[model samples]
Target: MSEKKEVKDQFIIAYLPDLDNTQTIINNAICFAKMLNKGLILLYISDKAYKCVSITDAEILLKELSSKITGIGFHSYCAIEGQTKDIINKIPHLLSGVLLVSATEDKTNAKVKEKLASNPDIMLKNLYTSRIAYFISSQNLNSNLPFNKVVMTIDNMRESKEKVLWGSYFGRFANSEVIVYYHNYKDEFYRHQLHYNIKFVMRMFDNFKIKYNLHLSSNSKTFVDYQAIDYAKENNADLIICQTTKNKSWFEELFTLKERKVINNSQQVPVLFVNPREDLFILCE
Candidate 1:
């Protein structure tokens, strides 16, 4: 008998009760997984308060999902688990590499009953605070693939390079146009420094042969998060990639709050949050 090949890292998709947006989540996950040459894992969890679904049912559903993604030149698996919070906490330790892609259906026009049937925001908060490389799909996506226009939000040139490095991979892989947006605030010295950093990142992009655009806002405008959201909408961007603000201390908690606001205001576009510590070399060919 041949020894089984151990799957190290995977792109995981959360399967909710309605499953209305599973295909969109799967499409993005597959594109990312194929780009990284990693496997895909479909994860389903049963809600105790809603339908009395068992692990068996979740497993069966996963099998059906597996059938749709088979022979895609990558290994795929299904995991039927309980409690999304627990799973999010343990994933980093359980797998060598993992990217969680979560999709939330839009309920703006749904009837009251249907709105009540959707998943709660508790797990969503957990995912954001977990510091994992994750993507949260906005509510009203048209279920498209190979995102043609992508936006990358950068705070400083120091961190902008990292953002560009990761964003370039998606741009090159999807053959998408990338726009780099930065907000100019604070003092001239800081603004000048950020511009230098942006230049540095642009140079790196040029060297890598990655095509992209740059946008910088003046300090007289609104909040940075709002500006970024507006720019994405104006461009009809399919995805917005951003780096989480560095967690320095209690004083820096505002960055986290701003990030949440940006996510909420994304207007149904997918947002990819890349952790600073994650290794990009493995993700790039």
Candidate 2:
């Protein structure tokens, strides 16, 4: 007989009723947790008020959920609270590598009676923004999400490159493509500056002639934000990468007009925030 391997004690996951991208999110998180040899906690918080749901009934459901995520242990909590995400916020905070795993649906439009039917994405999104007690609180700690590509926005070399590298590394791990939008907003960079930036990017890759998509971005003046979101939407990108860094300095946070627009308007795609140090910026400075 083989001995059961005990999963590590650092992971935690939440399960919502709607289960929109819940499974997808669950699968992704489990893969990450497994790699780190961690166990997970499964939580289900119902926003729907019920006068008859007993603790035993909820436990049965949780037992079923636990079977699916094998070796990943779980628990269930049913509250009288009516807000889902708010309920999630109230789960006991686990220190160490403890994390909150949540899911959100992509709801571009709202229907009259959404609660009557199940829409996975909408359900999860509702949980995140739910008004229930804990959810409304700032209970969720650091979050780790998978992403690839940064719509790296560049107008002049005013933005620091080292800053967004963490995001780029994430993209690399996902084996995804990154599109850097060089803002020739109204006018192009100094001919030499454009040449250097383009050539410099080549040095970062395998030195192969990696193909890039260039946009003159005519509507940048009035709608750079809209344009960036539209591009990410059209391309099916999971997240838009942005970094803030000090001008004429090495690396800093991704803080600027274009970066801000990318982060703010990234609709379905989350924004990855990164900050790099000065030594990382300079070429052996």
Q: What does candidate 1's lDDT look like per residue over 1-285, in tens digits?
A: 011335443444443444444676677677667665666666655646444357776666666776788434544444544655565656655543456776664535445343222342443445544535777775455465566888887664465556676677766676778888878757788778777877877887787777788887774367555677777878788778876665435544534445666566636556777656543322414
- Runs of candidate 1 with Cα error greater than 4 angstroms are 1-21, 47-52, 80-83, 107-120, 157-161, 248-256, 276-284
Query: C-alpha displacement of 27 in model 1, angstroms?
Result: 2.4
Best by TM-score: 1
Q: What is the C-alpha lDDT of each candidate?
A: 0.61, 0.41
- Model 1 is weakest, by summed lDDT over 10 consecutive residues, at 114-123
Candidate 1, residue 240: CA error in Å? Answer: 1.0
TM-score of every prediction relative to native: 0.78, 0.43
**For model 2, how big is the CA root-mean-square deviation?**
10.9
The Cα error of candidate 2 at residue 166, in Å, is 6.3
Candidate closest to the true structure, highest lDDT = 1
- All candidates: CA RMSD (Å): 4.2, 10.9
How far is 67's C-alpha from truth in model 1 (Å)?
Answer: 0.6
